[model samples]
Target: MPLSEHEQRMLEQMERALYAEDPKFATALEGSGLRVHTRRRVYQAVAGFLVGIALLMTGMVAKQILVGVVGFLVMLGCAVLAVTGWRKAGKPGEAQAQPSAGSGSRRQGRRKRSVMNRIEDRWQRRRDEQQ
Candidate 1:
């Protein structure tokens, strides 16, 4: 459900007042909840990876094949989780700044032309300098 207009206005006013009262504190708290949650997940995955490593080493010293296999699987799963979480977390403002679906191809076209134009300009400059 969406907030009523009056509630939104009140919330905005409170945010503004908080910023005015302590800009630094407000900035420190500005990270989105999703970003924080994903970061926490990544951290947990890393810790789990470390635990897996310890388990693998213990299994090796004890000559236990099953324990070693389980440890390897745990490490692999944690690594995958860490990678996915990191990808999802991206830069804090990246999701907010993304272009809409309709504009993606158009933006890519402009980017390609700009890159080609730069290369052409560099080639022309090199030719002129060699003359």
Candidate 2:
């Protein structure tokens, strides 16, 4: 579907507003960069667990549950990192700049599977198999 001319104009206006409100934020998002949440290897998770252990020990000695809780969070984060890596987590392809809902020429191409789509399919398949 193509965006109509009016839609394109509206989209541009919104973009202008965004730039006006936060030029730096808009600019910062303009380039290709490795997303900070990219996945890590299982070993990285192990490293996090180790750090958690040290923190836990300190927390135990100091009688500060907060310290231990933070360590636990680190450990959990590590696990999440490991899982994402194992699953080959990916970022979405560039959001196609369209001219609003009715404006502009519609670009056609293959869209990458979003992370949620991948996860959903996997879970759906697992569920079906168990039935």
Candidate 3:
């Protein structure tokens, strides 16, 4: 159903509020779905996977083990590429896999440590409960 006038106005107000509170986040969210490269990458990945499957079938029919192995590897790589592309597609404006000259690496390392610590703590708690 279409939103009522009051609901539309309320949504507009909320959007404005969100933008005012965190313009970067609002902009990122707005632009998340506008990545042409990501869509292309996904399409390429699908094509790569299909080509790999065809190569594998041909190799099997021709009794070429090396060709079949190469095709399997290509298929695996394409599958991983597609998954990563999908995950990163929502944040197209982000930089590539390079750390900035400043504290970017440190911040990422800290984030990783925090995540690992949380996982370790969870495991420890489970172990303690079991004991």
Candidate 4:
């Protein structure tokens, strides 16, 4: 379920306070972890692709058909991996919203709920401590 208006306002207030207190840390937190992981995957895939090209060249020089076929397969696999990672990385500054009610699987919904519960618990604890 979406946050109520009051909760949204509270969250925004917390975010602004966090930013004001520690801009660097808040900036770091703004980046999605998934984006970082996908970027790393894309980089690795590109490196693998280069290795495949080298293997293909070596096979050509040695006149080994099997080696050349393997290299071609490697390149194809790496290309597919890179493309998928790029797609998943998404646009910079895009908000990573919660999955829609009808979109995600049951397992994902459970996981999201668990995470949110943890966050709520932490928030409650902080509020209690402050009081």
Candidate 5:
């Protein structure tokens, strides 16, 4: 159902009250609307999951059992992850990995690459160059 103007105004007033009471909570809630990093990923995952279902259904009807089964499994995995996210309580918006504070926008994926992997990549590049 669509909310009326009065209802939206009331919600806005409530949101202001919430912001005044707890800025953190308000920030979190507001972050939810335009949280490009997290929400977009979740929305993409959900869309991919639904598309997988459609593919599975098409495969099943077309007698392509393997494709159907693969699609179904992929869909099931996404569903399980969506239902149980990283948190058991199913808070999907929260990042599974938090970035370090005050690191600017680079905080999201700042894991240190392993020294071994870096060495291996260097060796591989050298081999490719020689080849």
Candidate 6:
């Protein structure tokens, strides 16, 4: 769904505020170049997983429990890295931008609200009172 006019205006205002507060960060975020980094991470993870498998097989043949355990741990870490990289890479730009843009929005309906959410709430309440 598209943002309503009011929401769009609010978003614009928030963006301006962000830029004003930290121009350096705002500029740094432009043209993030994340895709290449993500791809590299994925490749590294795959390589690590393959190496771990080889180590695991060698340990099993040698009957070295410590080596096998280390190999298992390495495999687990590599699997986690690959999964996270894939997940992040698959997300659209909007989904990634939303959280950073509106750090105020409740996350997955969690009970603990972010500081920005509280600030926005206060601002809203003040606006309502003035009206």
Best by TM-score: 6
Q: Which rank order by TM-score, best down to worst?
A: 6, 4, 1, 3, 5, 2
lDDT of each: 0.80, 0.66, 0.77, 0.85, 0.64, 0.75
Model 3 CA deviation exceeding 4 Å by range? 1-34, 91-131
Error of 1 at 3 (Å): 24
lDDT of model 1 at position 114: 64
- The window of 10 residues in a row where model 2 has the poorest summed lDDT is 104-113
Candidate 3 lDDT tens digits, 20-53: 9999999887744546678789889989999999
Candidate 5 lDDT tens digits, 41-112 = 566567768988998998989999998988888788777656544233234456333224335555442333
Tens digits of per-residue lDDT for model 1 on 50-122?
A: 9899889889999998888888888999999999999778786664333333555887867865676677667
lDDT of 4 by residue, 1-131 (tens): 55744688999999999999999999889868889899999999999999899889889999998888888889999999999999788877887644554566888888877787787877778877999
Clash count for candidate 6 is 0
Q: Which stretches of candidate 4 lie over 4 Å from their true place?
A: 1-31, 96-131
Candidate 6's error at 64, in angstroms?
0.6
Deviating ranges (above 4 Å) for candidate 5: 1-35, 84-131
**How does candidate 6 fare on TM-score?**
0.53
- How do the residues 1-131 of candidate 6 rate in per-residue lDDT, one tens digit apiece? 33434677998898899899999997677544686688689889999999999889889999998888888989999999999998676554433443343346556434343455676667778878999
Off by over 4 Å in 1: 1-31, 96-131
User: Candidate 4 lDDT (Cα, whole model)?
Assistant: 0.85
lDDT of 4 at 115: 84
What is the model-wide C-alpha lDDT for candidate 3? 0.77
Best by lDDT: 4
Question: Which sequence of candidate numbers ranks them by lDDT, best first?
Answer: 4, 1, 3, 6, 2, 5
